[model samples]
Target: MEPIKILVVDNEEDQRRLIGIILTKFGYSVKTVSSAEAALKDMDSTNYQLIITDLIMPEMDGTELCERIKRKRPEAKVYALTGRVELYDDHKLEKFGFDGIIQKPISMNSLKETIESAVENIRRL
Candidate 1:
């Protein structure tokens, strides 16, 4: 069986590296992109099982990225990662079509659980 492919999008090199390393260790095929624009370009060729993007980014934010992704691939599972969780309400996130939200200073357990749950959800669909 092929490993689940996940994209981690973040402007911070450290954050992207940390997420990539952790997901890779967990037996996922992980890719990292520095911006939503890059992520969009990557998506054009790859079908990612899950996409986890930082909520606050330059030019295009995570919500905008999610919107764009959904337009092209409505089945795509996307999660918003942000330190400023207080800034977004559930309605806003739901409107943006995010499958889930991952708070910054991520907990490995939570990240794993979220990813597993998302994969399971995808399989059910």
Candidate 2:
């Protein structure tokens, strides 16, 4: 079986590395990038099964990034990893092309479940 490939995009180096480490420990193939621009460039060459991006970032925000990604890869599973979940409702998130939102201050257990569920859904497709 192939490992799930994930791309995590965050301006904060600590946040990026933390997610990468956690996903790696979860037995996922993870890649981390510092900026949305960098993430877009990386996507040009690679297709990740899952993309977790910070809502707030320099230059391009997660919503915009997800929108652009979806335009390119409509099947891409792009999600928001933000703390301010209250600011954006499901309608807004969906309109921006995000498949779902993952709240920040992440819980390892939930993260694992989320990823597993997503992978399962992908497999079904």
- Give candidate 1 misplaced runs (Cα > 4 Å): none
Alpha-carbon lDDT, every model:
0.93, 0.89
Cα-based lDDT at residue 70, candidate 2:
91
In order of listing, the candidates' clash counts read 0, 0
Q: List the residue pairs that clash in candidate 2.
A: none
- Deviation in Å, model 1, residue 106 alpha carbon: 1.1
TM-scores, all models, native as reference: 0.96, 0.96
TM-score of 2: 0.96
Model 1 clashing residue pairs (backbone): none
lDDT of 2 by residue, 1-125 (tens): 88878999999888889889999998989999999999999999987989999999988999899988998889889889998989988799998988888888888887888888888887777
In TM-score terms, candidate 1 sits at: 0.96
